[model samples]
Target: MTTISALTVPDERVLHRHELLALGYTPRRITAAVRDGSLVRVRRDRYVRPGTDRAVAAAVRIGGHLTCVSALAVLDPEIFVFAHDHVHVHADRQASRLRGPGVSHKHWRKSEAGDVRLSRRRLTEPPASRHLLAVGDIVGQLVRCLPEREVIATLDSLLHRRIVDEPFLREVFRALPARYRRIAERLDARAESGTESLLRLLLVELGIPFEVQVRIAGVGRVDFVIGGFLIIECDSKAHHEGWEKQRSDRRRDMKAAARGYCTLRILAEDMFHHPEAVREALLGLMAGHPRA
Candidate 1:
């Protein structure tokens, strides 16, 4: 019973002091918990679980909630690449002496109970965590803070995860500038990963005719099929490990080659970190093939 209840606090990440009190934690119990290293005092009225993300607790301590890429990073890790290596916060305009680690950007809003932000990003009530911004608001921040491709990647992940559909995205974009509405059209939930989303945009920019998740006989679905016969597989480093998996992939490639398909394997890391090289390689590899 204790273990099960423990999970709720950790999962919720941060809670107000009154909420902790309502949960039957007296001042002494709360203090003891803090001393025992189970509860962290984020601020006078905010308490975070020991396992809570540092950024979340820091934001709360700074009289703000996590926002922009930082909040999304916590809400959905591995969905979108980091826009910056720092945390972004949404704090009260009246709050002062604001300083925290890794908090590069702090968005200010009028202080209100249960009303996190409205001045900028026009945040709805925080869906799950008070310490976190709403998804639509986070996307709004991403659109304002990051470049086009990065923002689209965030939108793609949001769709792929079914956190928000196309219509909801359209509605949110409609409230933003005219150019943002156009970005919603480029999002496709079929993208299985951020790297895939980025690569799709790259292909579109390069005017490459390719299909995603194409399945061939004797082999399972591949990431992309280009030039009609070339199979491009995007994989992360994890896929390269393990001999059994490697053998299975080799066998699949052999089967694909037997069926007159040329297989080209690309790592997700290359697509993310060395995009120019990947682009050059793709351009050179398809130099002989007619654009389909």
Candidate 2:
């Protein structure tokens, strides 16, 4: 007579074995559900509702504890998920395997023990002060972690004070994909903006020649210039707010028009969420101006 919907989780995405026990599901029932494809095992003691998201399920099934970027994103859904290696429970000595793929363990001393949480069976993030970071945050942090010669020194000053631990920094470098390793080497942490970084990468992929942070005749300095006829501006909403930015952008557009250069404004949302649309728009715009 116990309906699964009768149960509730502290975090909708995370679930613990004891929570299921409290719900009257015995080990036999749990195993039966798995056999019947009615439940998915996340970790040794964890079972998530069948067909749950892979990341959530994995977090539950491999529940020694997770921290760093994966934990941060899982705990704070506002942050986007990008990195692959999930930081997991670690002791000074190697422990028995927790039960899942894609899990990375770090040997934490007792001082780092209480950092992991088991709320509803899902992994959670450590405090920001504890040197945890997300993918976006890591991109900025790497500028300082790598030697000055490895990346531009300008980036060091930008990220030197920013929080990223030595371990997570090493993980990112080791995990860097072959395709992105070269780009990683060229990253400058003090570059002033993620929008600028993403835009530059896109432009490079698009084969558009341009200058960054250069002043136009009337529009002052834009993010990029293409053929001196197009001005590209990258805006991050977190940095821009209210009617004031809108008005300033409008005036800048007018000035660019007066100087005979076309203006294209790219927002962070457009870049991350609607990349295809942005790409199509850029393609259409460039159709009129073939590459020379």
Candidate 3:
């Protein structure tokens, strides 16, 4: 079986030295493994799998847990729709030596309660890994750092993926500040993508009449069907990229058209990079298209 060992750690790729040593790998053998490219060194005492994610490695190298949306991205990249690229780290408040590339945000927990012993925030720091932070902690951090819509989008992803359930969400919400707790009500697991969740948030805020992932007899399941007649699809580049997918989508739109449904596909970039333009276009479309 393949094994990994590293003397130090800066990433998830690093394997534990103890695991190898316990497996009867002598120091000489470890060195031989390194020399033969069977093991790669991330730092002194840390050996890891060769093909681990770069951001994950960077966070571990920085002596911190990868966390927040950065952790979410590693865990389920498809669920990511918010515009955050930098690796986020959760580190010690007193760590003096924190230096690395790719880590733009670092988080250290603090207690707001007067007595530190009675603090609500977790004091425990789990083993640093490619994806660190508990689901509740991740949600809490998202509430603190991201905007309302973005947080809801992530929450929707967690819910849709069954990474979290209603009870878990309630517990998480109960711990949050009152103002933020209410946003939890807007989460809908029917959102299949971060972009879909984002669009749902817009529709919710605008009080638009719409249903998510509605299936029409002729057109199959759609991202959103608005006012019973308008079909809105939040197309991420991954979904609508090639000519094959585009051709398939056109066929679906053609099918929807036969049933008197108007389809409006929005590029995910437009939603992320040009929100106002997308909102205006949707508003114009809704105005012209009569409601069912």
Candidate 4:
């Protein structure tokens, strides 16, 4: 039996029986703490103080660490947009099959010649089970795991919030295959939201020349300015759905019109669900205003 002391465990509040024993705690004392409600068993060997993050608890329950978008969300919930309902977990390729409610398991396969050097790189840090993949590793996994549009949106969010710089993202891109490099090239740090980033990507795919976060004399700052005279507003519900915001938007549109700019406001639904309609409307707008 190993000697244990209260001073040996750091303040993280999670502990394993082995750790407690090494710190001079007896098995009897460990049982008493659990019985008295001072420690909660997360699993067979893992114990944590009450009120740990449920997602972290879930990751521990699945016997893996959070990675990809799930890790990004945990690292910075303010900026990273992890829209999926399932909690993402990362485990070794040879690990046993994972089964649980609301868990998305990602197996780390051996890295190929062109794949990111996931195995060789020190992208993971650990206390064994509760480890988290580094931000750069998460970004690399994101590109490989998510759709291209989603990758752009996530990267744009990361860039816009200055959570990660362009150089760091370029490094992440370099870890990818040649075909995936275009995503890095198209990234813009000025995008204010995922919707704006998605809209910008759509416009680029349409071969439209645009400027982001353009300011007009009367209108505050428009999302995107195309051909120097057309204002495109990608309206996210959280920001633009309120009556006060709608009124402010109308005022801005009128101000833009006075300054010889035509405003096209595209809601989240229009841009996401009816993208072709958005394309047609943009084409129509461009054709009607040749100067724009």
RMSD of every prediction: 6.5, 13.3, 7.8, 8.2
Q: 66-103 in candidate 2: lDDT tens per residue?
A: 33344434444433333334333221123444443333
Q: Compose the digit string of candidate 1's lDDT tens values, residues 218-272.
A: 8889989998788988877765778888898899999999988888888887887
- Tens digits of per-residue lDDT for model 3 on 1-292? 1002121122345577887899899999999998987876555566656677775666555555556677677666656548675566665566655444333234322332111111124523344343355556656667776788888888887777776676777776777779888887888888888778778878877778888888899789999888878999999887689999999999999999999988999888887778788789888988876574
Model 4 TM-score on a 0 to 1 scale: 0.76
Greater-lDDT candidate between 1 and 2: 1
Model 1, runs deviating above 4 Å: 1-11, 93-128, 290-292
lDDT agreement of model 4 with the native: 0.69
Reference-based lDDT, residue 231, model 2? 81
Global lDDT scores for all candidate models: 0.72, 0.51, 0.69, 0.69
What is candidate 2's local distance difference test score?
Answer: 0.51
Error of 2 at 106 (Å): 20
**Model 3: lowest-lDDT 10 consecutive positions:** 1-10
lDDT of 4 by residue, 164-224 (tens): 7887777777777888999898788888887788888888888989988887886788889
TM-scores, one per candidate: 0.83, 0.47, 0.78, 0.76
Q: Give the residue spans of candidate 4 off by over 4 A.
A: 1-40, 49-51, 80-82, 93-131
Candidate number with greatest lDDT? 1
* Candidate 3 off by > 4 Å: 1-14, 32-37, 41-44, 81-83, 93-131, 290-292
RMSD of 2: 13.3
User: Which parts of model 2 have CA positions greater than 4 angstroms off?
Assistant: 1-180, 290-292
